[model samples]
Target: MPQATVMERTPFIKPNPASTQAAAVSDGSRIGFENVSVTYGALTVLHSFTLTVNPGEIVALIGPSGSGKTTALRAVAGFVRPSSGRILIGDRDVTNLAPYDRKIGMVVQNYALFPHMRVDENVAFGLRAHGASEDLIRSRVPECLSMVGMSAYAKRYPRELSGGQQQRVAIARALAPRPQVLLLDEPLSALDAQIRRSMLDELAKLHRDLPNLTVLYVTHDQSEALTLANHIGIMRDGRLQAFGDSKALFRHPPNRFAAEFLGRANLLPVSGLKPADEGMAQVRFGGIALSARNHHGLADGSDCLICIRPHDFRFSRSAAEPNSVSGTVLSVQWQGDVHNITLNIGGEALRMSCPPMTNPPGLGETVSVHFNPAEVTLVPEDGARG
Candidate 1:
């Protein structure tokens, strides 16, 4: 038995019952993990985790490498068994079920296609293994290939196709079985940026066409999760930090890890010992006063931290508005469509990304930054406030 790695302890938030139930009932597929924990030898890869995926729903598992996103998918796919608890597919307990008996289709990053088999034959392999009639395999293989726009290249072997085409074949092979759940493990990571973009479009179309298929997509790409998944599960270490619709989690992350991981955020530490009316408090940062929403109901003489997104920070040469911070421009990088500016403030580097570089400020110049209080999140410095 080996020791559990440091990345296996990240926390995750389960979706509320209303959201989970609504998503499950609306979609045709249902997946649920109840108090699930998995250990390999002596290393516990997943904690007591629970999550639900509705039918026809695409849930993107986003996290750092070794955070157990793939482990969770494998648990659901029956590749890895939970040491305790149950996995339910469409309300049936499938935790102890065999991988082949689980009836799930998997497409991984490597696009593992049979080297000797032609594209059509690769797509038909699963159906044939499942003992589908020859007529059904013939009818379904072409249709699956056509769905991924690989019908014309059905006769091409895996080695003859480009990386993207081979991935399409892999997807075709996975979809040919039409399993209750589709598990995609970083399926676009093998392709170049351009091909990845094109495949995303094709995947989006596939989602629209087959609205009844439950998709459990695993990726480390944040932008891909944002673009493809209606619901997102943010994992850290091995725990799920947050799970909700893309919009809700992005708009309001429950913790500092989630706020920073889901996207770019500017964290500002603040402290004060006084409280205002109705459990609300005014904390000062960099000699400027700011009001906190105080969802944690802070008492008098309690310290709190503040978080503001980089985009939320607006810049102006003249300091005329409230909630302004003064900083010296460190360096600037032109990213074609936007300018990423690093500013030096209070011994910490603050980054600001502004739209399409036009008349940007010069480096070494001092600038005033403004941010809305509403856009700011109030978190306690010691993991107390959200």
Candidate 2:
């Protein structure tokens, strides 16, 4: 990996105890957007969105293009002023502050390195802009580069380095100012898959080294958000759909958009649902009665969708088993460690992931798939927020 190569060039710098204490004395690095909104004339880009990012936490905002994830990040950076509400960093209001005055660092998707400048000069740009002394800039430049494991390439120009190396320079430049918060706007989107994965590890390590640095990352990639974020905020059509810990949100999404966005979900339409024993629901799908854990306020005879992850289904030997559905295997795809089996059950296609070591039914073969009731989640059919 490029970061590993850079790490080999210099010893990792540990944060000094005294410096840590000084940095934490007034640690107001937490970020909050209270009922914020942004508009461009008649079109609203961000709705009345509100979320809080804890100090030193990495919060990834994820959604499709035009979903307002980037707009929220830009609001925090002070590039686009909010049309309503306020933005807070720690306890101070930064809603009206200029981008540079906000003391925030941003790394854009393109890396945005100056082509003509050497890496060291690029890393020194932020410090110089903030009017740091010459000696301080000199000392900080090498330290930032070293943190990113790019100190040895400080003399090289952007054109002379590979894509991964250039990204490291961009990150080093952002960190040089020692801003209270870091905003990453799809910083790894330009790289290839392997390089992107390597850089993700590097960013996680960088966060560990800088414990007080709060990060608000924006990306449309679900895997990136799941892997790097402590909390994830899902957005669509300018509205904040859901916000919670990455794992919890993925496991128990509040709405259909969130369930479908975060990962692959089998959203099966169910009817004739009634309250059963122990906070469970009995629902009928394709004339078969099945039990599922009920958390949503589903009334008797109400129709809803049942959400079950692909991995939650297992291959059953017979259709007589509880919560079993008989189907024909439409396709079987080998995905390295597991096989993804697509089954056509009563005209509906359901996907299930099976371990490669286990025997998955061949294509065009009849099969029975089973899932435990506890693994199922019920979502409202209308999907209207109550």
TM-score of each: 0.86, 0.89
Output the number of the lDDT-best candidate. Answer: 2
In order, the Cα lDDT scores of the candidates are: 0.78, 0.83
Candidate 1 per-residue lDDT, tens place, 234-336, comes to 8876789889999777766667777778888777777773565654567877677776556556555566566677787788556666577788999989889
Q: Evaluate residue 370 in candidate 2 and report its C-alpha lDDT on the 0 to 100 scale.
A: 95
Candidate 1's C-alpha runs over 4 A off are 1-28, 272-282, 291-302, 383-386
Which residue pairs in candidate 1 collide? Answer: 7-237, 11-240, 12-240, 12-241, 13-241, 29-55
Compare the candidates by TM-score and give the number of the best one: 2
lDDT of 2 at 79: 69
Give the CA lDDT, 0 to 100, for residue 87 in model 1.
89
Which digits, one per residue and each the tens of the lDDT, describe model 2 over residues 283-325?
Answer: 9998889888777677889888888899999978777777998
TM-score of 2: 0.89
